[model samples]
Target: MMKKTNYSYIGIAFIILVFGILFVPKIVDRISNNDITRKESRSDQKLKNKALKQSDLVFIENTNNGENRRVPAFSFVNQYGKQVTNKDYEGKVYVIEFFFTTCPTICPRMNNNLVQIQNTFEDFEDFGVASFTINPEYDTQEVLKNYASTYDITNPNWHLLTGDKAAIYKLANEGFYIYAAENSAIEGGFEHSGNFALIDKNGFIRSRKDAFGNPIIYYRGITSEEEGTDDNGEVEQISILKEDIKKLLNE
Candidate 1:
């Protein structure tokens, strides 16, 4: 009986040793490879994406009235020679830029970035662009049309617009708060902001907040995604702009 009891204890000890040798290393290996934590992290990310909210973006406000700022009403002739107004862009997400076809620098880069953006959302009918030419006198219907063709502007909603110079300037300066003036001293014989304004489907200007939680009113358009940063060491915002555009579209 004593020998039988000792043999039973030895048998139980052997089984425990075999179990540790067979399974313990695999569990340790899984932990070392982060197999368990990785799945948990992916699940957490999915939950966060599902909870996306409209508050992720900021509504640019009118400093004077402290109300949400909106794109002012305006009328202009598009590259196709059709009249377009603020009402035309209702229920659409569009980017606004002040550029002329004859610009010697910056304009091309800006438009190239815009072209990339246009292609990114080619399937979305509500995505559009409004290129208001500061030099309306020179960028007539024909010139704007040719420029659009050269840049491969395929989006039907993209409108290279030109009209009364004063109205365009008013739209640029007072309406959008983007600087635009006839400056012969500049290389392009005109001066305008190289930033782009983002408008939501409701015609209200929208933008993402900065590091300090302040609305970054406009996106830098001069730097391309490939460039990442310009000669002046300014970081590119095109990627972030695209992300924000998606956020608004989903909203």
Candidate 2:
């Protein structure tokens, strides 16, 4: 009887020992793996949130010919004779527009808008503005220089760029998503639409605006315009977009 009792006690102890050996490591491993997974999940969520917020941004639509579209890689030289590429404006709010120096209608208003923007952020050092002339052939460095002088655009942050006709057209169509084409025969040398493209710091198309909050054009570039521009059209012109830049700079 004593032997049997001892054996029974030993059996219970062995069972408990076996359970501790088998279950403890598994529990520890599960918990450790869960922690790692949760950390990764949080990191991934942050990236996703950034991307989604980028998508929510609104910018002037890219009018390819007449239809709205997204822009492609644009490269040009500013009045200062520096090669300006899409890569230069990363991590900053960039105001891009398609215009010629001699434009009688929309170009002047666009420049005025840019001038106001320069004044608004005269003290701001992070944001930037770039304007591309559709008539690159006539709007050469000298022509741009005269135009810049006329507007008193002294801000070092502003760039008036002129480059190869094909390159500029490509940039207008591809980089900035504007209606730009080479037509020396035309009175202006080239014909393109009037649109101001507002790009966020991440280099994604955020919102496109006309003179004011007018929804003359709107496209996000990643998705269809009809779909992408729907959610963002409610926000007033440059006001919300400008605030976004301020918030980003603050961050």
Candidate 3:
């Protein structure tokens, strides 16, 4: 009777071991699959957040051009006698401004404001500053070089560009969407917006602070009201611009 009872106990133990062998791996696999799904869900959420940050930036859109908007192709000569086109700034972040060296009204302040930004990011190689001359006739490369000296601009990263009026105007008005016209009444003999434009590395004009304020919500770019003043309104512009640049860089 003792030997029979011992055999019965061994039989029960063997059955329990066989059941664990059959079921344990499947249970572990199910747990591993759930963990993989959880990890994938977390990755997707991070990507979604990153995309939101990129799209939150202001975009200059032309419904006529469909949903995708970009800066038109352009070619010009920089102050250093180098041919500057969209290629020069490809894969890099940059700021573009429309101004002539002869302006006695707003260009001074614009230059000064730009100087501060330049100084701030002077060491950043992936960044650049390009100022286009509305009066290309007077702002030849040599002349631009001379004017740039006034603001102590010594870095080649800060390019002053000049080119044919028709191309420049098309780019300014249609590409960058800033107003550039021959106006005899304006102090500089030309009428152009003082708004500085921010361009992403992908050749898209990300933001324009101009008269239209096209979207009317973005405060990072120049505004019609802010451009008219001589005070520190641009201080706010500088702050926003810096923040936006850092935002883009991080992404």
Candidate 4:
């Protein structure tokens, strides 16, 4: 009777050992995966906070935070010949770029990249692109429409706006902090910064450093060499612009 009791105890211990060997690895795997997810979440939060801290951007006081920049007022006409103004963009996030309809180099590259941006964020109703024509006389509403058609741009949210030369130039220089000048020597007879800005719904420009390391809320345009690279390896300034927009949207 004592020997039979001892054998029973040994049998029970062997069963428990086999069970642990089969299920322990699965439980451990689940725990490891959970830890990785938590780490990724923390990393994302850190990046968002870092971007918000850059002094290059202006901010507005709000219920959540007391810092943001306010965009100045403006009146312009879109490609469809409809008037566009500040009220139209009251609750929208958009990027503004200066480009001419006809250009030999940079403008074409810039505009093409913008098309990609438009497609990438097409599903976002609150976001859009604003391509302002520096050559107002040549890039009239009709000309802009023609240009839009060639690019197969059917999205009305992407506005190609035109207004008084002085007013437009004022916005470009003082408001957008970009360089735009009438240079006959340039291929397009006009020259402007290759950069574009990501504006929040409240119109605060996103922050990035300028060439001089000044606090600027604009991304420099694709130029002669070495800069932002996208996932597919096509070099363009739009990649940086795209990432910045995503970060703002997530916030």
Candidate 5:
């Protein structure tokens, strides 16, 4: 009986030795080669890669000078009645829009899209929005403040700016090439493009190239992501704009 028990113990020890010698090193090697990751971890890694897998964004250039167009210098009072200038956005990636609080047509849709963007980047301190009211005469700091509240605009960097009418129009029409003018024929008594300009950290305007390889220059802002396409068949660019903003932020 004693001899038989000893044989059984020795056989078990031999099998354990074989396992350590034959399999342990391969397990260690798999770990070292990153081939032993969990399924969840692999999925997460794929998502990270996809998020970062975007083509380079292009700088919108001046037709006459062949130089990168930049956000021109301007100063205006924010919703909080604080002075804001281009200097305030020096190292930030921001969106610029011309809007008014009392606008009855496209402005609401444009701002709703912007507010969605604001929520998406709420955690990113360097992301912001500059809403220049085309009707600054009516959109005083108080009215702008009320509008901000109504829209639930919580990002401290987002400024609903209002100031000199002439300067604002110049910034819209000449500086950014987004039209903003008084038009009694328009429903809102003012007319402006429902487009948003994207600016990089260094203040240069940036955009993704179109299918034909030209800079799209402006992103459509009047359509919400949920709406997808409008009555005129204009597809919403907000989703792409958000992705491009992420690219600029990473840059």
Candidate 6:
């Protein structure tokens, strides 16, 4: 009986030890997974809040220009035979994009997305969209008018602008911090990229974003380009660009 009791005690001890070894690992794994999940949740929340934090600043400093200059003004025309200057649209929301009617690729997709923007803000009288033709010489008012018609872009708030090549190039380089180089072979105008310059009601350039990703500002045009091998690339991507625009509009 003594020996049997001793054996029984030994068996109980072994069982307890095995159970503890198995249970501890699962407990530890559960803690580690929970910690990781918590961290990720916090990170996502931070990005959400950052996107919501808009700015009231009128102007943002740009470094793309050779002189690291601020955009002061631009002189261009709308398709309706009206002259437009940067000063004309003070305290109104607008967007400016670069393109020619003859772009063989990318521009079409960008414009299709832009149409969604045009329709979205058509009712907002204070908002407008402007597209400037890099090939101003060929993109006559008539050409722009026809193009606008094809897209059903009849919003009075929208403007398809064309002007002298020299002035447009200057505006592209100096005013908007965009590069519109004159390439002989490309049809509609110059070799330009796809970018959108977002300006606020205060005549200040607040944000520059891509043609497709951002919300359209019923006031301007859009542009696109392939800078490098298309692997997670962001060319002239403005930091806090969207937030800055929102801030200006809200203010």
TM-score of each: 0.79, 0.61, 0.72, 0.66, 0.78, 0.59
Q: For residues 64-88, write the lDDT of model 3, one tens digit per residue.
A: 8655466677889988899988888
- TM-score, ranked from best to worst: 1, 5, 3, 4, 2, 6
lDDT of 4 at 5: 96
Q: What is the C-alpha lDDT of each candidate?
A: 0.94, 0.68, 0.76, 0.76, 0.93, 0.66
Residue-pair clashes per candidate:
0, 12, 1, 7, 0, 22
Scored by TM-score, the top model is 1
Winning candidate number (lDDT): 1
Angstrom error of the Cα, residue 42, model 5: value is 32
Identify the superior model by lDDT, candidate 1 or candidate 2.
1
lDDT of 4 at 19: 86
Per-model root-mean-square deviation over C-alphas: 12.9, 9.1, 7.3, 12.5, 10.9, 16.7
Instruction: Supply the TM-score for candidate 2.
Output: 0.61
Judging by TM-score, tell me the better candidate of 1 and 2.
Answer: 1
Q: Candidate 3, which segments miss by more than 4 Å at Cα?
A: 1-55, 208-236
lDDT of 2 by residue, 1-251 (tens): 99999999999999999999999998899778988789899999999977765543344444556443434566788887788877777767767777889876557755765676677778877788888887877888888988999998978767898988777777777665578775778675566775566666666555434567665443222222223232456432444445555654543
Clash pairs, model 4 backbone: 58-69, 59-67, 59-68, 59-69, 60-67, 60-68, 194-221
Candidate 5, 1-251: lDDT as tens digits: 99999999999999999999999999898887666576668999988886676449998888899998999999999999899999999999999999988899999899989999999999999999999998988899999999999999999999999999999999999999999899999788998899999999999999999999988999999988899998999888999999999999987
lDDT of 4 by residue, 4-119 (tens): 99999999999999988999887788678887778888999999897875433434333345555456688899989999987687677788888888877688767777777788
- Screening candidate 5 with a backbone cut-off below 3 angstroms (N, C-alpha, C), the clashing residue pairs are none
Query: Which 10-residue span in candidate 3 carries the lowest summed lDDT?
Result: 216-225
Q: Show where candidate 2 strays beyond 4 Å.
A: 1-55, 58-71, 174-177, 181-190, 208-251
